[model samples]
Target: MTLRLSQLIGGQARPALSEAWLDVHEPATGTRYALCPDADGEDVAAAFEAAQAAFPAWSTLPPSERARWLDRLADALETRIDDFAAAESRDAGKPLALARDVEIPRAVANLRFFAAAATQFASESHHGQAGLNYTLRQPLGVVGCISPWNLPLYLFTWKIAPALAAGNCVIGKPSEVTPVTAWMLGELAREIGFPSGVLNIVQGLGPKVGQAIVDHPGIKAISFTGSTAVGTRIATSCAGNLKKVSLELGGKNATIVFADAPRTQLFETLLRSAFQNSGQICLCGSRLLIERSAYAEVRDELVARAKKLHVGDPLDAGNQQGALVSKAHHEKVMGHIDLARAEGGKLLCGGNAVQPPGRCEGGWFIAPTIIEGLGPYTRTNSEEIFGPVLTLQAFDDEDEALALANATPYGLAASLWTSDLRRAHRLAGRIDAGIVWINTWLERDLRTPFGGMKQSGLGREGGQEALRFFTETKNVCLNLG
Candidate 1:
């Protein structure tokens, strides 16, 4: 039975404005499992209307009241953790453990952290010789939030939680490719008795619904997570309206390994960093920079490790990696591998897409791939392949390593592995990325600023930064006698 998905207007799941439906395929097995509305501007306008209606009251509530609702949402999500994890794994072709252990948990944490932040939401007051100045952090009216297919609910909540915590009503659009879990969120929202229009979920093609959200003047602010090209368009649109925008876009991130780093830990970390979630994550270390002293060893070991990853159904306990999200995306990733060869890079290992024996034979699966002998500025090295593919390069010294790492147009995130405390701290500062992990990758803290620099993205999001982005500040001054 194919499940039907609808646009979540106000607090309920209503039929889309049109009867046209898009088939939702289960990425793990390449089977049609559901249908989502092929929503249009009418659906978007309806959602915007709901958000505008709910904005006045929702935005004026005491921060603590919003905090309580956030907590309630978190509690509800926790109760459905297993279900969400399974749905996410099946929906996105992520290994079930990865979904259960990382993606879903982080989403729960995002909600909880933002809920606490709402309780602690504070304004600023300055006392001066002449007068007193007070700054108010208040919500914009109705806001638009668009998240990509990659992280689905994890990032969907990341944008909306803070927007809601800041007291804004949100009209959210989750990618049509992976809309299941977000629709699930809409179902949960109704159960929780959430205020109507506070957080409406719209599922559709980005061109249709996403464009409508961006074009709608009623939406005062927009927070989007996706490719740089789309983000650029959003930025231009928002600029025309003088609307606030926070974009977390693409990344061609790097993993830097110094010879001084422990070899054992480095190998394991690199495997997960490069191949985890089939490299669908924007933060995945797609470019690897190794010290010349250890380049050969790291490259050889990475190939051997890549061979060991089992690509199959996400639900299988034995499989560490799963299929790409769709056949179209699978071909796109495979094409990059061919592009690497055409550009004269040597394929270290794993270039061809595979049909893992049994159920996964029907799915869209690509083996983890590594390409070497490419220059720093080569397209394969600089572009975000955004699949289970990596480009390996060698560097002679710290200066050379930094140059190679920063060669790409992106400056999202990177990982550094070295034993020297001084060198670790030094390289951290030199790396142009927003988040640099010394001897680690993907370690996150809710309170720290998170986002990219340069073409990677604009503005930061996380903890106070997220709350700040979703809100506006008004300063008032009074003269003293």
Candidate 2:
């Protein structure tokens, strides 16, 4: 299959406005699959211009009409589901089942959710007899969205759906590594007859194209999903212009299994949480903090389960854990594995890469790694590895578990597995992360607000709350005397 990257601007594919280009690789074989144009400042400016021009008309449309466009876009996406999944798997090393079953479906659902949410933007009531006052939700004009490589389609939809639902034009900058699916989405938007300039996509490196988008005066807000470091940079740039910014950054999330928790159930939940998408999730439960009494049993089960995970080609139907995004990411994950050893963390099981039976040797595959005995301050415990690696730690009591869970700078998400209802409620309240799951990990409802509390990120990204984030409230007060 041949994949070609194109800039989607003004409702059409256009020629590259930049001189540079990069190869999008197929991680399973370490081969270049397509040449993605590296957009420069001029290209980003053009996208901004498109969005800025479209904003007035698009935003003026009634909320119900805006929703119809999103509904149409969702239908369009559904028609191309298989193609989207295949490209997602090839471009980002996601397992085919995951792309088909989880990512694409979730993306479609997000669009549908936002379509319904768009019509709920009624004016806020003010209990004041002094004057008639109500707040109107208004779009922020143009939103410049930068999505990460991991779960590119899902993250892109997370931003686009709400931005459009709130009646804003969007200029999206997907990660250069995983631009194929995002570009295809832009094409689908056009096919659905979304007005020209309502949505635009420019593929390029962050330093050049991303910076341009952030710096563009025409862009009223910046929504980003990526590493905390890059998020900080984007925040700084937005601050210079006082542009509205919402970021979902890195995480070192924890999964605390209490003594009363069902051991088998917790083990299975952790298995899915820590290794899904090879643990490339920002909200993945990377730290497993089991109650001291149940630590031995949980660790034993986890190690056995980790060994059973299938590591192989993403295209393979049976593979559970696939390769990291690229050679660079694979090496980075290996470096963290080496760091774990240096920090005196015992390698419990599966620290090295494995070429699956009958799979090519060149695939960027890494085994499900488990390490134990690392101190809370150790790099293995403190940093976000963004790979299929889980670190184990034991906590004696509830307070210690909560402290360990909140120790990291990140506060993206956390999970508590316990049959004790009181303890579950108490810890769920105390955990500093944004989303706390009781007896589950990484399970989310589209209608609930989702985001981190601390350095993890700055704002929420789901449901009516997310719609508010994309819009500014204006108060219109009039007096009739």
Off by over 4 Å in 2: 357-359
User: For residues 82-169, what per-residue lDDT tens digits would candidate 1 score against the true structure?
Assistant: 9999999988999999989889989999999999999987888998655999999889888899999999999999999999999999
Measured on C-alpha atoms, candidate 2 has an lDDT of: 0.88
- Candidate 2: worst 10 consecutive residues by lDDT? 354-363
lDDT values of the candidates?
0.90, 0.88
Off by over 4 Å in 1: none
lDDT of 2 by residue, 1-481 (tens): 5567788998988756855678899877778888888888898888888888898899999989999998999999998899999999989888999999999988899899899988886678674685777798889898888999999899999998999999899989899988889989988877777899999998889998899999988788888999999999999988987999999999999999988996656677889999999999997899999999988989998899999998898887878988889899999999999999998999988889876655446878889999998988888898889999999999999899989988888899998899898998998889988899998776777889888978899988888878888999888887845
State TM-scores per candidate.
0.98, 0.97
lDDT agreement of model 1 with the native: 0.90
Highest lDDT scorer:
1
Show pairs that collide, candidate 2.
none
